[model samples]
Target: MRHLCLLVLLAASLAAADPIYVTAFRDPCRAIEVHRLVLANEPVVPLTVVVGGVERQVPAVSVALPRTDWVVHRALVDGLAPATEVTLRFPGTTERVRTLPADLARPLRIATGGDTMHKPEWLAATAKALSARDPDFVVLGGDLAYEDGKNGARVVTWIQTWVASARAPDGRLLPFVSCIGNHEVQGSYGGDITKAPYFYAMLPLGGSATHAIDIGDEVSVILLDSAHTTPIPGPQTAWLAEQLSKRAKRPSIIPIYHYPAWPTVKVSKGEKDPTGNRVSKLIREHWVPLFEAAGVRVVLENDQHTYKRTVPLKGGQPDPGGITYLGDGAWGVDVRRIFPGLTWLAKGAEVRHGYILDIHAGGRIAVTAVDETGKDFDSVDIPAR
Candidate 1:
């Protein structure tokens, strides 16, 4: 079956001289698409891609920032064959992307993390550690750049640093799928989508605050807004219910969003906005039942700078008939202490780490948390239900 994608607004082109970063993903309808964005000074440029020996010149959409020398040229390359190698050439440099196993019958490898901010140095280190895993693609849990999705210069520089540092041991650029977090928007919450210009420019979800992608009929990944730009129980929530209902029979369905439904850090006495309790309450009220009904295998969460795994839970209690929640993102961010002995928690640790998940077609998923030094400190395997 041909891959399906949400239509993207298109404009501009990229050049050979610009620094190129490649990312690949299974689209919303199970097709594999690859994208490359370059930060350059040139205007309206097209580049060439040699895929499995066939070469084609592709157009790019430019996202130009005001008062900056950097112009981001983005190209979405589709109709790709997995398990094969693809190469892109630009005057003095050439980059390569190794595709994942084409057949969904085999194991699929994915790396995930988030909350990368404040320290570009840690971002680099964590990027290297993740790269060593040689992931097919990455899923980030938001908070990409620190404090300013509105600042064009900071956004561009941060993206450049990320692109330059996040590379596999073989030097291939791993593709990433992510949602926006508090850091990606001004005021950190309740901002309109337009407030985060850089995020909208960098990653467009076909004009929606939330979206879902299916991986070869085996797994469905739902990415949510988490009140960053859209409120829960509104349009995004309704859309999520529809999505989950549609994908109910999929072997694995995983949801990723900014705030955790169960946070390991930060208690809320209802004093301020953006507190853990407030965010988690919103999710539990509007989304948890939908998840329970749909049989979502796992939920990936972030915004807390710690690592946590909840016992398979149903309605906030440990139940085998429920969902597993993983995370409290610590990727490149300073670790905060996690109070253990929480009722819903199975494990909790404050560390600088990211998770690698190896999923099989049969529905079993294995997750390993690796530190910045590339050591596996925690591991878990969830057998197929």
Candidate 2:
């Protein structure tokens, strides 16, 4: 009789548990998936979620977060109309998710930045400002959460904060795209994927962190690992070459990564080498050539906490016909100082900001930098090639 009473109490406790964090993501910008990380109070059974009136069962998968009892459930909903709103019904919550448009004729707006979640207040302000812009999606260059790949509770808080603050003006949740940075791993550099467990669990970017996704038919955004978990040379380089080659004729092929090839701040002499030794050098040698050859017009880079835009350059010299690099992070973190006498830099500033890229139908992108106060600080116009 005692064992039966204890078992009844356990079952009742599990039945009353609710989800802690529920958010949606677009992996390839086409497939929409929802992840629900249940609260650690109790273990819950598999639950059914309704996506667009269709019921799908989501099973709970145990997440190995140190000293945490959180479990995650995933549900992928397919065959939805583009640019349309779909309703997602979890047990006690309902969220509206907007799908990316499939038509290339319509203009698209993307807001991007990195090095976020350092200070909670700054992150909330930046997220609110970006949400007010009402962008189609967001791309983070990395250093997200600042969890150091171990603090799972911090990671959970970060996600919850983002989901709460990063909503469109119309109240729809915006999808997220990201790359891995040094802070995402335990070693901070040159470590394997095992070092960044929360990143893999939270953001499912296929298997590898480096991958490419297309928005409509005109633009291709390539997200790179930046030597954090994956090396700059070897198979990643080969994959990059192939992706660029395949999209050679694409109107806009933009690469978003963590480290900058032409850094705004000065790197120590000890970090530079000729044989593609460092992250920046390896990118310049192995990736920049591919980018230049493939006619990549814009590159988004982060890590150094300052805002910077480079002059169009080819072969290390400013040229009218060359790729332009935008950004040195500064989203929700303190700004850094830029090295003086850098000829390649067209514009640089010490400010917390994010980029709003308005991609037109013909591939011309009007880039605008907006600060935490939602004020525009800088603007650049890139013509279609």
Candidate 3:
């Protein structure tokens, strides 16, 4: 009887020490038929990821942090039917993943926010609230983990918290799409890629800071670096123009970046730029024209820690047919005060919130702002462009 009890205790210990703590999905972009899963494990064990009936070996890579127990593994499950569900069997657990529809014939929900993880409890609350809404995927503009380009352990904990609290109502993990923020880098601005080690190590950004993802055939989500690891001008601008030109015909072209080109708060004390904020000047000069030409009706901007929505803007002026910039990223952070009498702002407030974008059939987008309690406070409807 004593030996049997000891064996049972041993089994319990092994169960508690399960290596896989973090599991996240990525790159549900143009590949409607494939899904990518990124897993972080504490032990370096051989993993065979089984999706549907097919099996694939996923090799683990060591995270480039000193004295850390975590390693990263990725698996790509392809040949999936759009809008179908599949079960992924990984070692000791299973996860349900769904693919996006090939066309926008049905409604899809995408939740987006930024400036996350200043406080773990706030992040937990906000993530749980967002999860209850059951978005198909999430796009975080940046400032995730607040690790300041270091502190790998903090990044790990943040991911664990997010995966735990942000699961779908059906217990499936939602795919994550992210862009680089100032907090992701060591120097905070205009630095080399090596400074932001933790961000690149965890995310599958194809080794560059800027990339675009197409949701079905109607919407294109363009994620930019916003001067974190990559600058805003020259090559990045050229690439932005090219990407916009290629997807110019798409009904919705949404750009998600860390800095707001139209800020609700001052960039610095005593700043007097007629453009509102001087920090985002380069983005205004370089990328705004491209956005106007491409007919990008909506843009997602973050990092100011206040809720904001600019009037439909053309050349910094309000126009009926122009782009509407939403956000100054107050997700899971202390809200900031909006500058008084900002002529460009249609609405500005001190609120901790995120956006739920309901993309319906026929290219219409219903944007709803939800607070940490899962309550809707603001909403706007954008017609098909």
Candidate 4:
């Protein structure tokens, strides 16, 4: 009788949980199938794809979620042309997912921003402005939720905000890729992966703390962990070197991390806490060289809560034959002052804004910083090398 009562309670609890489902950014991407899926309370849900008036059920592998009612599944659905519209159906809902450019000959618009600390007004306004641009995808720099992803219910609200804000003008959901920042963890640093339960549970980036995602043949985004969960100059550095070495021949190699390698507004250099200095040192000593050698034309960064652009430099000096660092994420937060007396610093802005990157063929790129009111405050153009 006791066992029966417990079973009934469990079933009732799961039944009461709200239904939530969202798509994740492709990690081990094939450029053909949507490999990431998040479905709550629906295990082994059917995914139907419609193409040319033909509907077929796709096979999916359900991943086990411990201690939660949410179910995650991955499906392999291919054979669709790029830019072609296709309808995907689940148990109770249907959505349209756009395919990549058929020939990879045109430009790719990407929205880049971060530091959304649970401010609903800023989030909604910025999201609304971002969707108007019709970006192909979004890359966030970190500090996703003000709750630090420690509270379960708060994390749920954050996820709901993220998903709701991801709708484009065409009504298609845009894919979001992010790097873990200090706010994602409870203590902000020196904690294991378990410290960020909601981050790991919600965004599955190939089960690795650091990973890279290639967006067609034009660009490869190498996402690094800036001492949040993993240390710099250690295992993640080795992996970054390997990934960059292999993709060196590609047209563009861009790196995006939570902490800016060259911060615009900090005088301490993290001497109080050794972790901060260590992260800065490791990035400067180990990773920057690799990026320079690999022809990384640009680097995206955040964590300073301001807008900044560095002069093109080679080996940390102002040189035309070097990479341009654009960053200091200003999403849902107030801006801070830029540190003075830095020769490498080209331009800096203290404003609440985000960036829109227009990547064109032959390695030509343009970045624009736009505030929450949909105003373009600054713009930079990096010509083809």
Candidate 5:
């Protein structure tokens, strides 16, 4: 009778624990898939979560983790409505996940800023500016840090400033993607693939299985190695051609690289830096002809530390339907004269610190160039596809 009385009291006490609850996924850009429901306040029980009434286990997520930062684990559920609020519940919690509005009638107000990351404080400000705009996905068009041949530890420190310290006013982590930059190349010009260890380690975004996430596809994004470890010939070259050819049919295609084919500033070309090395050579001679032939839309170039939008040209002459090349990356760095305008440039950037980008969505494309002050320096509305 004494034991029975004790059992009854224990059962009553256990039923009173709070339901474990918190936001599961914050990324508006990630494909609608199952994501691990992590605790904002870590708990001890290794709690349980149920999506659509199917129970799933909660995994350990720690802010203290640097290498595994931004990773979701264990559970993955799919087939979700975009930009909709969904519910999730755990024994002690329940939180509402509101997906980003999937139906963005206009260009998905995306903000593109790069190079604001060389200094830690600058990244904080960059994060602040981005948090205010809350772009669909932030594009780090490279040169995020000035490691100058540093170790991964430096990356962790820099990431804390560039990524961790960043938060939306609503308390969301601004997820950004990367393209290779000159600063990322260890030698500042040429280095082996291994030298760029930290770059790939941080952003493992290349997906070979899924075309959308693949390095090159419709809406293809070709990340060039520059003259870094991977030369523009051989496999990289073959792959580049394959990607460009594929981009011909896609809605939009963009190419990103560390250097320029039509350099805004005069830098000594490497003796070994063939036309292929410059990218303009093969890209123009081999690839551009194909791009023009196929209809590749944009080629994003950097390294001049300035902003420029090259006229759409075919064989060096202005061709209205040719292709547009924008950039001369000057994100966190200072700049020279390469003006930003519809016509102020083959190269005219008298200002510094800006990011150039295209907003791709809803069968419509728009280009907007934002200066460091977060002002729209120039924009063009590309007609819907």
Candidate 6:
């Protein structure tokens, strides 16, 4: 995960001497893959990337280097040592550059939900705020941009702004992974994945526009496509079952979508789902069961404006035992209510704000709600291990 730093700082760092940069991620897929864009004025010189004493010369994303902007080149480095520093070096660049450590110890800090983006510095402010504290990575639970599929070109500015937080804290771009939200659907939520052209373009990195990215053997962060491309029961259901089944050993299995299974916020009469609540119904019927069977931790939810955290229950009651579902998304946007009586909620069940989830030395994940004023209002801990 890239820490929060200025792009200019990286450029300046390179100005002194050819700088070797490293971007890191506790990839949901277990191993962390690192990619780099090399820039040098001394013609084209061969470069070799050394990681933890291993040397491999990987190819660039494009043979032709960008004269101005940073170019993206990516590759997966499998079987990596978790909780350890990884480094990257170009021959004779003075010293090697290492990737940053994971944000948490036994667990990791991962904030989620989508559709909470809007306002003047909506994206920028949240990015700056989160960056200030230094988060390992930023995940768009959904609704990254307000663009409603008017045209592929729409949200270009928002895309540019949204991607700033995507950059590594060391100034490298971290992988900004997201699932399909209602706003991402074409025109509205009742559409298919193909209608979200701009989204497909932004996330060309792959995941079927709806796939799961694993964090480690402990956590499986599955991003569902409840929007346009895939449906829950028909095709996606089978895939979701397979993914969950295969990752049964995984301690925590969390899914992020544009819609909500049980919304804390009210739905206006005229409103229809952009991502279909029926999909959540499928998730409730076919998916949540597997989550319980698999010892899943919590599901990162969004779309409805209010704040919510469902009782971690196998059934939707005050069962002393259940999976805690977190989020109704109020990151930057305004919501309708703060929830009535969420007895099952761990915390922030009715707050209108964002939260910072810290994973400690153990697999305990802590949630602290922070308002736009950078104040902490509430906190809770959940065992992610």
Q: What is the lDDT of residue 131 in candidate 2?
A: 82
In every candidate, how many clashes are there?
3, 0, 0, 0, 19, 23
* Model 1 regions more than 4 Å off: 1-17, 24-40, 270-276
Q: Is candidate 2 or candidate 3 better by TM-score?
A: 2
The CA root-mean-square deviation of candidate 4, after full C-alpha superposition on the true structure, stands at: 4.8
Q: Please write out the lDDT profile of model 1 over residues 77-139, one tens digit for every residue.
A: 666665667787654457777666644666787888889766878877777888898877788
TM-score of 3: 0.88
Off by over 4 Å in 2: 1-29, 41-62, 270-277
Best prediction by lDDT = 2
Error of 6 at 293 (Å): 1.8
C-alpha-based local distance difference test score of model 5: 0.50
- Tens-digit per-residue lDDT, 1-385, candidate 5: 9999888856643442232212212234322222232323434333343345565554433222223222222233344444544454444444444344444444444445455555666566545655566554455556767664454445544554553444445554443455666566578555664566556444443321111222112244455655555555566666766766655556666566666665565434563322234554644554566556656556666766777777766665777665677777666566655422233245456444444344455334577666556576776555433
Candidate number with the higher lDDT (3 or 4): 3
* TM-score for each candidate, following the candidate numbering: 0.89, 0.88, 0.88, 0.84, 0.67, 0.71
**Model 4, 266-372: lDDT tens per residue?**
65553543224555667888899998888888898888888888999788788887889988877877678876666787888887778888888778788888888
How does candidate 1 score on lDDT? 0.75
Candidate 6 TM-score over all chains jointly? 0.71
Model 4 earns a TM-score of 0.84
Model 6 ranges with Cα > 4 A deviation: 1-106, 151-154, 163-173, 205-207, 268-279, 338-352, 360-363
